[model samples]
Target: MKQPNILFIMTDQLRWDCLGYAGHPDVKTPYLDTLASRGVVFERAYSACPSCIAARAALHTGMEQAHHGRVGYEDNIPWKYAHTLAGELSAAGYYTQCVGKMHVHPLRNYLGFHNVELHDGYLHSARYSDIPYQESQFVADDYFYWLKQELGTAADVTETGLDCNSYLSRPWIREERFHPTNWVTDRSIDFLRRRDPGRPFFLMASYLRPHPPFDAPSHYFDMYRSMTLRPPFVGDWESTEELKRYGRIFDSRTGPADPELIRQAQIGYYACITHLDHQIGRLIMALIEHKLYDNTVILFTSDHGEELCDHHMFRKSRPYEGSCHIPLFLCAGKEALETFCPSSSCRGLIELRDIMPTLLEIAGADIPDSVDGTSFLPLVYNPQGTPRTWLHGEHSYAEHSNHWIVTQTDKYIWYTQTGKEQYFRLDEDPHELCDEIHNPVYQERICLLRNHLIDCLKNRPEGFVEKGRLSAGKSYPPTLSNA
Candidate 1:
């Protein structure tokens, strides 16, 4: 029997609630919604670590950032780990190809991808540019010339306001023709059309959009012109605590923007989503068109959620649901989809570490015993089943960092600094607005989660950044940096 192919589509900084099926009234995610209809949608899926480096590294290797040691923005994996999904699959007689942003291993960062077009997220970049072909441009791979062509001009990329971190205050351009996203789509489509017809392939096409700059093509910007926009869940700025909580960040914008600006931002976000959706649609259609759809296992997800001023924060790094949760859609083959449902939705919590092992299982490849994640194929197929008792995520945001662990009914998070660790019960307070670490009622549960975090840190070496910065037991090294 011929092995099945896997097509994984990942979008950068997408929210879990934006998918139409997730009940966002304005998001035009028809393809995603349809995929949801046929596939298994993990409603509570979360990024193991909210930051790009931790989250993506975990996704690439089936180990948490703590184990993989890819903690900071520029940290690269030392090459002892063997046979990533791409490498293993390729070795198993599969052609592996990757497209778009996968912010990991800086140069030629194909963990296992034999053919790749890597695009790191703009949010991850501390710099910005419009020149498509700068000799000094980061990761000057094959996508540059195609970017120049589809995006019209290199100068427009910065001017057009599609840049993810571009300030929302910039003067608007309603008639801008091409954007970075268009180039992404064009290149992806070309990649698809040019794929080898005979080989079983695992193609991962990543899209960076609905992320920032709040810019899109003229058509995408006009998507929500006549629609009534949904305000932020916590829109009121009366509370000083929330404002004070995010005082450290530079891009925090408060006070209201012009309705048009808000609309354009939302519209830009939706447009990017719709734009990406169409690209995935084309991928699916190509699969069907080439008679490859039936054998292809499609998985769509994002690195982390973006905070569109949810708690008055702009980009993601916080521990809020807005920043932690992401959309996980798995359009299992016809057999898998036919057996999908909503009964007791994927019971126990699963983390980013689980993805690699799961992908290895789906691909029918050998699972590296070094991998830290447990396969969820049984959970995906079993309507009443789920994964582990807890899925954990950790992030070192500035001097303050949070460790998240959740069970089916209970959620726990611990953030330590200044010789104190704060814990919260998300079941009691789903929004996680208050810290109950000191509370006597949940002391036992809090202690359990704290122990878990400690044990996780114990797996690393003494000199490891993760072990030193975030210690479970032995005196943690003073600072968690290369400095």
Candidate 2:
């Protein structure tokens, strides 16, 4: 009974419905499609705090946002978790390594992996003028440092004049082989070629694409540029005035005003996804060539999702389905698949925190006492098993900050700044085109979900709940006082 190797694959800002296996009509992700077909896909997976730092905090620590203390998208906060996914597996005699996107403070914090080949993908905080030379992305990020050496210091990912967070896009200015997505795969394949063969290994191959600067190779961009694609879904609650207010700004949370810009963004985003998918296929082939395919367990997911102009929103940190819902699946060898993943898909609700305990259980390692998440390994074999009754999610995003509760079939959102509420019956409106907040038919269910959120926030330091009710306009911080 030898322990199986683990391949944790993560993509940044990837929407839940962007893959062919997810029934997306426009995107081409044949490798990911095949993986989902053979594995168990969690049809209702979500990121509780749908931002990079908060989501990764949950993923690595197996703790919810409140427990882990990151509720928003702030950067430069130190990561101080005692027990991490990689740390636990390393303690259990597995050699652990992460190849890309640690995204932690001081630019090189390894959390618990034995080694990390870092590339956090064009962070403004890391490249600030006041930062020391040694800690800057130019010197600290492995991939960026290599790029400078190969093409001189003047060469940069921003050479195409696109902001990292902007919806504007173009093809990569350099060779396709030098792209960050390809670099992650290249380094991961190299690791497989020279890993410690006697012991099981835990490898996290994280990619930063389909996020922004939407610069895939030209060939991939051309694949979708000419095809007719679906337009963004507009909700009944969205205001035309709000769209016009922020639409003209680059890197706006509300998307662009021009329909042509939105269409081009979609073309660039889908191209980046297909480019990422092919890179994943290369890793899969490397596994087979090394005869490690049968002994590996591969889990694929994203930190959060891009809004892609859904409901007129462009970026993440929203409570809507496009920003919070994420794709999650597990593919494994024959024996593990037969014993654990007996079904092709499960309807159970899952969050980023659950990844730690599930992978630790698969590795025969100890689930640390600090973890607040439950392993969903049981649900793979028994799809009816409940991982959780509901999930409470929130993010601190200035005036648009929100709190939400979601079950498998419905959702409730409360805007902290304005006390605005929105409800949606997801089983019927999967795209969330209609807001049922004022509808009489769902008032009872909405009240129940609201109470769930109140209970979740009652003990928090921010005083979100007061005298058995939710209070609006409370001051919010990205990290809790305890953190």
Candidate 3:
């Protein structure tokens, strides 16, 4: 069997329901919609940790959050994994190259990518001054250096004047070509032209857009600026007080104070997705132009999701579907599509960690026994195949930490600090509007899920469990950084 090229595309902080194929009312993602029609879409994919670094850790290492040693958003964590997706692919004779954000510690650390054109957008920890030469963002981030070269040394994200983590929206201050989204695609196309043609390639085109700063190019922003965007899901079970939990700028934990601001942010976010979709289309065209389209397996997904004001939450690091659920689609090449199913949707729960083994399977590379994720490649022909029964998700940030057990039909959640329980029937209430934990009808259901959660946490390294029970009020701080 011949090895097929793998084109893995990832976006940061994009929601699962933001695409037109997801039945989104207004977000126009024609390219993605078309791609979905030609691919198998994983309807229930999720990110276990629901934060950039931890989620990427699971993605890169094929290990769950607990196994990867990061349960929350921690920066500068040196990825010391001996076995990585890229490493294995490279070992298997694939030329591995990453064109965008890796989010790994010692920011420039390529893990096992033969080369990385790194660009993690506006990370404060990496940009902080007094950084050592080995860890300096100025020297590490290829995009930052390129931006300086194009816009002069004085150029910075501040030129846009939008808060990096805020709900504020704006058009890109520079030319659209200089946008990070465009840069990733441009660099990826360059790689296609310059790669070793004899060897099968594993190219990761990772875009940092649709994440935050809500900055899209003017034309793309115009596409949604006047359009009526989808409103955030304000669940009846969610406390209104959560809207006021944090201020209105820079890492706002809660939703916006003004409802109009929410609309603006959604417009910007949707625009970013569309902008990203256009770039994806360009890259696909480039693949065809380079004669690599029919023989390459293209996978599109995200590291995690952004709340976009869902349940009065604005960002990731939560157990809610808005933050944890992610988009996943795989389109095998023309020749490979004969064995793979297309225009299909699978309900089996898939996680970010699954990407590693799935790609390894496609490349005929060895799937390490240490990997916690199982390949869904078998499901291409057997869509009805039974997958993992459930997925355990958790994240710790601010004053709260959450642990959750999600199955196909329902999700049960527990707040470790507050010991609050919430349950939602995903089959009926996909938006999670009603929490049925207090409903007597779900007592047995809730108990089953809680026990599952307890079982998952029992042997956790963080010791969130004690004697087969979750230790309430336990504080698990971020300790997985390179420091």
Candidate 4:
């Protein structure tokens, strides 16, 4: 068999339930839904960390956040950790390229890639601000530079609002118009058409949408109105005292309940997702139009899910399903897809870290034994294969939460600050409305999973195996503090 090209599509801040195929009947993600039907969509896929910096690092290095120590988006980038998939693949001779967003430091600076088509992050050059004549900006510097370059005078604009709605309005959209979500299709199509025919290329086109500033064209906005949408399946998580303790109004860990406003925000979010769905359709059709759909592998998923007003809350931070359960799908050569999911079922527990190894295994590239995740190739082949049931996800943020180990039947949540432990019988309570954590009857299961979390925390692998390249703030200066 010949080596096939790889196309990894990653969306930012996408909620797992926003896609039509992901059980959201009202949402229209036609392209993604079609991919799920033809490919392998992990119905129960999740992210290791809910924050962008942490989760992206885990996905890139195949390590948990604890290992990478990238606890949050606002946190500094610990540069000396592990060699990323990009670094490994580019060195292995693939014409690796990434567009849109690479939150990691030193964009296009080869954290590992031949060259990036879009330098979309932030920039802090001395020439621009007259700050200083330094050689560079922050490693993962400016996220808006590409938009600035593409839109010229139009880029010097800002629309402020706590809601994604104002951001989605014409001003922000046109301002960030070179937004990878809008222009990524153009760059991806160009790569597929212009790359040397001999080398198998690996292109990762990351889209920033369905994230926030949830405004979209009237066409998509027309598809959803504040009045027509459904509130979270479980909005008042405070119904029970056990759940009540975890409830918060907002993320700086403050705010009051404003139900109507949250509802409107959600409507905007749905609009953003629906808009992204249309863009994805264009990108996928381009794959088919350029005649690369058959030979190339297309994988679609998100970095992390946004927590939109679940439990009177409006962001990601907890181990609730809304924050951790991300969507993951793979569509490619029939043989390879069959080899991974011969059973043809879109149900299984998958982690973000597995993406790297799965891509490597499918391309017949060598996966380093040192990497933390196991390739889901076998599970894909036998979707029901003696299911590999255990996946480890971690978090270290404002509260110093330890780790979470979600298995086939139960989820054990451990927090570092209070040494808090809780276990939920997920199969019976998909929404996790009940906290059986302290229930005496389920104490046995709780204890068992609690042990797993402890193992993950105590014996967990120290992260960013780059001997410091990926962990310590060495090779790379800190990440975007401007955020």
Q: Which 10 residues in a row give candidate 4 its minimum summed lDDT? A: 469-478
Question: lDDT by residue for model 2 over 83-186, one digit each (tens)?
Answer: 99999999999999999998888778888999999999999998899988878999899999999999998888888889889999889888899999999999
Report the lDDT of model 2 for residue 364.
86
| TM-score of every candidate relative to the true structure | 0.82, 0.99, 0.97, 0.83
Which runs in model 2 stand beyond 4 Å of their true positions? Answer: 335-338
Reference-based TM-score, model 4: 0.83
Off by over 4 Å in 3: 245-247, 480-483
lDDT of 2 at 287: 89
Best by TM-score: 2
How big is the positional error of residue 444 in model 3, measured in Å on the Cα after superposition? Answer: 0.7
Can you tell me which runs of candidate 1 are displaced by over 4 Å? Answer: 75-81, 121-135, 149-156, 161-163, 166-178, 235-250, 253-264, 335-344, 419-430, 433-441, 458-483
lDDT of each: 0.64, 0.91, 0.87, 0.64
lDDT tens readout by residue for model 4, 1-483: 777778899888787778877788677788778888877667778887776767787788877555555655543243554467887777667789887766554343456778676533332231255443232332233434444455553452233333431222331344234444567767776777888778888899887676655656555656666356666656322443423454333322311245555565676677778777777787778777876677778888888877676654455656778778888877785533444442265567777878878888877778876577777777666666534567777665545444677887778776655556667778887766666767789887776666665555453343322322212211211122221
Candidate 3 lDDT for residue 127 = 70
Residue 102 lDDT, candidate 4, scale 0-100: 66
**lDDT tens readout by residue for model 1, 1-483:** 467778888788898888888898788888778887876677767887776666776787787666666544444343345657677788877888888776553445678778887555453332346433332234353454445554454533455434446425332353332345554555566666787878778888877776666655556556666778786556222255645654433345331234455445566667767766766776677667767777778888888887765555556766667778888867766532335443234435666677788878877788887688887767677745667677766666544455666666555655544334656555655545666767799888877876676666555444222633454333333223321
Highest lDDT model number:
2
